[model samples]
Target: MLNTSEHPWKLVGPWYRPSSLGGYAVTKTALNRFSAPIIQKYADANFANNLVNEPQHSLRFNSEDFVQPFSGDPNQVITPIERAQSHTPLKLYLNTHSRFYVVVCELHCDVAGFPQVERNKVCEAGFVVRRRVPVITPELKGKVETLLQQRSQLQNDLNKVNMQVKTAQLQESQQSSDISGLLKTKSARLFSGLQSGTAEKLTEKLQDTNGQLDQLSQSGDIKIELQGWKSSDLKGVGNWLPIEETPEQITEQVIPMYPLIADPTNPNHSANGKTLWFGVIPTSLADVDSNNNPRFDDADLYEIRCFVRRHHSQFPIQKNHTDCCGDVIWSEATEGYQIAAHFDLDGTSHRPVNIKLPDLPAIRNQVNNAPAGRGASARIIAPAESSLNFATDSMDMPQGGEPLTRAGQQICFFSIFLFFIVAMFLFRLFLPILLFIFNLWFLLKLKFCIPPSFQFDAGLVGSLNFDGSFGADFNASIDAHVELMTEFTADLAVQVAIEGPDLEAKFNQPNFSITVNKGKDNEKTYVDEGVLANDLGLMIANGINASDDMRADIKNGGDSPGLSSLSLNELAGIFIAMQTEYQDVKHPELAGILPTPDSGLVYFEKVELNKEAA
Candidate 1:
């Protein structure tokens, strides 16, 4: 029996024969045991009898003129349909025989499409055919199961290795962070230590010393002789006249022994043609006696001595030229000529003595009273005994032993004071040397206290571990003993013809895939020990080498070490020599040292003369 709910089929043809008879009828029914006989009887007796008896006339009808039971194109192919589903009819045929007419129809069935099948044999046979049977052997199944289990184990091992690798990476990262922090701290400490230690102190000291030396150099006195005069020439001179006083004198006189021209405009001219010569008399004989009387009579004037001065304005004069009177001497102050010639008043020399008569009324009266024709040369001579007596009496000398003893005591006290001043000066001069010696000893002691070398350990240890992996597989197989069988049957006899282009279909099997993975795991750990110690050692070695080089430079008297190259004794000696030379050159008066004689003093002289002799 076919259940109507499961199989939906409809019947359309129960046509009567004659045109007078009614049109065909359509009904939906189930082919079940209860309704089957009634349906068959109606079709065989009533419908068939009417068709056989009345169908002598021909009938023509278009398929399109009738309403189709189903919608869509009847000629369209429907593929890949499921089994037992209903399909539309494509064509219908009618036949007549001696007994009755028959109707035949060509119909399509709905069957699922198979891409693996090449022909319609399966559909025609209505069942698949198998030539060989395919089966899974127990041994093969067991092997596959074992392989799967092994793969699972390998996956589990890989997971564990991944966890271990992650842990190692974490440890390495932490260790690196710690090392970086430690290095930062250590570097800061090293820098601070170097900044605050011996090198810094030494640099500061050197800078201070250099600054002091610069100040001294700038502030110390410098001696310059602007007048081009030697120290001896300036000995008794209070101050030099300005250059404006002697504008024509640009350079020092090269031959000062020779007298200079008295007047630039009149070099070869004298003051007057008539030369009035004079003689300089001794002060002892030129002054009056205590009685204010002349010491020599006119006849005794022959014993007097006198010098005459020459008058000339000519060059190339001899030192002792006596053509007219005596040697000529020039004076810058007087801007005139003088002489150094002397004569005896006893008439032993031919030179005339032109002495100016003393301005006394008594002497002038005696000269005027002389007889005009007597040829008597009246002269006045003062006594030297009275002037000597006055000088001797004017001097105040210590009169007794007590005053002399007091003077001696004063000299002793002054000597003691000078001794103490000298001692103090000596102490000051040697103070730098003493201090340098003390500092050197102290520094040597400190140097000896330090150890030559040092050792240190960081006490650090590190370890690391890591692991990882990859794999792929491909499998393909064909069944050798399996086949498919199919069968098909149809009751109606009909011919089918395919039209137009032949139907063609192409199918391709899907491609298989393979996956490849590449993995790598590597781990390394490093531990550095005594990093600080190594750095400190290098610093110390460098410092020691520098110190050694400095010491060698000092001992070798090289200027690389600057003033340190000089020993305390040598430095002291140099300072003392410089001080002595400075004093001698710039402050000879302070030391009671006289100026050294030079050629310039030979032409200039400074002296005090009595008023009567002037």
Candidate 2:
């Protein structure tokens, strides 16, 4: 009985049939001989470096496709090759017999049209197509009818002959292996520890082993063992390994080495490009996988090889374990007698081409100034509890102090009170006059407030005096504003107190989120994602420029012209502005974003400015 489950047979994707099995074998053999050795060694090493080789993808508790959120959606489906990307089928029709009949393929079903027998054979690497068989021709239909009869007769004849050949061959190969093993046992006896009679017995066993070995080895079923057989009897033993045959290209493949999104204009279909394709998947390719699959500690079993388009044709790109790293591989099916020897991928890397945007007022700066009263009206934040940007969202930003969770806060507040008391006692005891003078000065400062036109020391803000004098201030009022005539520069400092170099430890939690919702109206009403580095730099630069102008004015006998006055609110606002402008200056857009810095990767048509840290 014909066991049809393991129906190993030739398959051509609506393309031409191979002329003979010889052609397919020969082409593939040549390719294997030429390329496997060179590539196999290095292919694995390169694959292991990918992030996909990490444990995250294979975690039993985690969904491997977690990176692709759509995987969980009921409507989402993985696309088949043809329609997954832009593709035009290299279409053809096959006639296994003189008359074309349907031949169902075991592995695929998109194609099923062929006649039985008629010496149907796949002789090339990919069955080569001669011409498209159009059904429009009328006389061709008549020929098909006659050819069907011939094919039916041939099929019956082949069925009868195939049974005897296959069964006998299977039994022979299976039996000869047993016989060869027996010979090996007997042959080993000659080398055993023994006396004269034992030696004679051993020699006898050796002779027996040799005789059986000769019989078994010379048989075609046991061709490999024929190496030890008599030279004359070894004839045609190695002939089971077929001779190479001519080949033709039946499909093309390509791979790109960067994150590629196949443009999906048709929303009705899953976003796997517009057309489906029919071609071989490189995931099954041993060249790429032999080294890649086994050695990686947590490697992905499958590598997606996309048949994408660049110059308006299909090519293959190997998606690295990360699914993002890689270069495009170009492949095409042709009638020429050649098969893919090896996939030669030129290493390619993608860096986003420099993007330039003008520096606008910072929403992030305003976001940063949530407590400092920049006003919520200046930002375009959606209704979200949190944001992905660590700097923008309050709950996510890093802060490294004991949490003031009710009880914890009470403990901390008490400790702070005790600390100040101890500090005052020590100061009063050790330096009585100094303590008295400091007390008297503070008393005077409160009793007789300095005019708005005068300046004071910079105030610090965050925790460890980062409020840039008042850098990280927890109590900055929403209604605070600085007089334009005083030296009240409120420099904002992102206080980072590290006992050592442990960022992951110190700021691991959301320490910077303390006063996020403090003053809603004081928040920014812009959608700008700008940060504060450049904007703060600008404020400092402007301060220097203004001071120079003031000195010039003072030299001309102007009233208090040399004075550089900045109120605390004005300083805070200016510092916020600088931080906003400096953060998003993508190296290429230095000037437009803020005061143009000379150092970086772009040659601006405008003059580059000398920069100093803000």
Candidate 3:
């Protein structure tokens, strides 16, 4: 225990958070900072200078002779601003890194007789900016430092739990592998059964190992890391599956309108997942025909079929479950369900196929979704279909034949002209209402784009080739196989995205809507709160800047102030509070070291301390 400081300073704290605009990857501890005047000066002069060095206003009149044109006494013309006057205006530069202080109720004396201190959680930090150092007041530093140390200690406990889970899995795998060896090596002796040994016992042991292996496979923790394999090194990989099953992971990912990083898998960067599928503008890509249409080849369609099935299977086929390809085989290896789809891309929901998943040898791997199910879902994980061939028909309003006007049971052309003039007046009065109705109809049609327009019959018509490997496009694979039912209906080619915990729908028009089902037993749909925020921000930011929201994005992308921009010292306070909250609200087992805070512990007098210490 440590002794309390004789005098304590009053201080405030602020915390740092990942700047929300760009999804900058930030850990809980890494936060922005702020401070009052005195502390803010210290940070600007010391911290920002260290990170980036440059003089301000030094080159005000570049080319020295320009000063000759203005020959007044400099002192008379310029009254020097007082330091206090300059500092009071609050020009704060948040030092992303700074610390705060806490109270030290306990003391341990070193050989020099000056006591070494433990942190004081109760002390007030009056650390101010503008004065030299943040007023750490010998005592506050002790407490803040101690709290930081304690937090480091607590995080270890959380890591240990994860490590324990990993270790247990490894041990189980080893035990099963050993049993498999025993069954193979000592088969004859084990089968003799003369000395209480029976084939059933061996079979039971084998089943146990197989079951263990199966459980481990579905454990969702087996992250198979692969070395970059060249064509030369593409030899048979061991019992481990092939890496060919991952590209579909990229397509299923939902990125918002934000720009994507090339090879975005690097751990250093954070990228948005729920992006619009039509992010690429119609004319922005490599090439388009005279009709401004891009091509989605038949080969791409076949390739997409193999992509979806190779990774997912066994999803529930209930109404609430994701709509998967009906013909694909279901297994634990592919953990998603299948559904029959029918797409009618002919400007009507008329053609429908018994949408079947063709067999592809790629059914080799499926990884678990991230923690709290952040990783993957069946809806967004479509089998890599290309949109190059999808048709983009223009929609024009219908025009009626010439009209006739009837007056007193006599229809005449001159009366028709008078009626037309009156009709124009009525149209002007109801134009907006008519537009609203049309837009509402289009939105409703977008919602049903998938089922009514995109399902196809996928049966082995007459001995189809079941071989899995083929060219990049599945065209050859389909060409080799034959389906008895040649007839099929096409509906709107809709897509879905399972981004993080949320799901969204993509219509052929490629506009987006929210997904309403999680395809789980409890029947939940992942809601997208970010999209709502994005939409509101777009409207608001657009109005504020008098330009497109994308322009606002460029202006604020790297320098956005985030939700809060406290002064440097204030940030330390915020982070401390956040860290404290993270500790306070953690599960009981997770909050082992921190004093169990409650109404009783809120006040100082209620806290019992070892006052007997010198």
Which residue runs of candidate 2 sit more than 4 Å off their true CA positions? 1-11, 14-113, 117-614
Quote model 1's TM-score: 0.11
Clashes (backbone N, CA, C under 3 Å), per candidate, total 20, 83, 88
Question: Candidate 1's error at 336, in angstroms?
Answer: 34
Let me know the TM-score candidate 3 reaches against the reference structure.
0.12
Q: Of the pair 1 and 2, which is ahead by lDDT?
A: 2
How much is 237 displaced in model 3, in angstroms?
Answer: 79
State the lDDT of candidate 3 residue by residue for 1-614, as single tens digits.
33423322211111111110011112321121211111111212242332112111011111111111111211112111222111111111111211111110111222233232232222111110001112234544575456435434433332333333333333334433575444323432322222133324433454554454345436532233321111222232212113333332322211111112213453322111211000111101123233433221111110111111211234433433322332211101111111111121211222122433322332222123224433223222122232112222375333344222222333212323334446755654443233232322122223221121111122222112212322245554454322211111000001111111112111111223333212421121213434333322222222122223233342224244321222222222221222221132422211213212110111111111112111
| Model 2, span 1-614: residue lDDT tens | 22222233222211111111011211221222111000000112222232122101110111111221112221122222212221112111111101111110111111122212111111111111111112223534564445445444433333333332333333334433575444433332321212234435544554554445345435532332100101123332211111112212212222222211224553322112211122221211222222233111111211111222211113233322222222222122222111111221101000112433323355456557576533323333333332322232456655555332332211111223334456755643434233122322122112111221222212311111222432243345412323211222321222111011112221222221111112332221111112222223233333322333332332222443111233222333333332232333322221113211111112111111122111
In terms of lDDT, model 2 sits at 0.24
Q: Which ten residues in a row have the lowest lDDT in candidate 3?
A: 486-495
Superposed model 1: Cα runs more than 4 Å off: 1-235, 238-614
lDDT of candidates 1 onward, in order: 0.23, 0.24, 0.23
